[model samples]
Target: MTLSFFQKFWSVLANDIMAVISSFFHLGQLLTAINHTFISLIPKIPNPSLVSHYRPISLCNTLYKQILDNVMIAHDYLHFLNGKHKGNNRLMAIKLDMSKAYDKIE
Candidate 1:
């Protein structure tokens, strides 16, 4: 059965399982930078000229993130909410310290 344009879009977004997070370029484009995030240098202190006094701000597309975020929120709520995991034996989590991680990388 053939699906309409809106129907296809709805299905794609509603059932987005995050299988493919990739993007491609169209004709005549040498490179496609759709996932390129906007980086901004933000000052940590009031005012300073030192490079170490600033932090990098990453701004990316939120449209796709919201889809994954909704799924994660639901999963976490079911696993951690009030009395949700009372009988669970163990809890597992991974924490990554991103603070100052990009300072010397650049």
Candidate 2:
């Protein structure tokens, strides 16, 4: 978690990382510690004209990211990315009005 770790690792090739890992222990859940989250707006250009130019950055605990990644995998959110499985029936999406989609998201 220190800047020196990242600096030294990239500076040399045969650095021994075992010394840093020999003192590690299991990090069990601690609910009392407040989770810190902040949204950073990354502008695509030096001068932005629209909201589309902004990118959102959400940072959270490492364990929280691991849990969320597993949940997304279980839901098959990107199952259509690979063409390995063939579908028997054609799927159709009927869109009525998508302009005001975020008005009633809850």
Leading candidate by TM-score = 1
Q: Summarize candidate 1's per-residue lDDT along 7-56 as a digit string, tens digits.
A: 56766664442322432222333233435677778888998689989888
Summarize candidate 2's per-residue lDDT along 1-106 as a digit string, tens digits: 2334445675462243333233232344344322555566778788998988877756554333455566588456445444334576544334356446522211
Evaluate residue 85 in candidate 2 and report its C-alpha lDDT on the 0 to 100 scale. Answer: 48
RMSD of 1: 11.6
| lDDT of candidates 1 onward, in order | 0.54, 0.49
- Which candidate leads the pack in lDDT? 1
Give the root-mean-square deviation of each candidate in angstroms: 11.6, 11.3
Give, for candidate 2, the lowest lDDT window spanning 10 residues.
16-25
| Candidate 1 TM-score versus the reference | 0.36
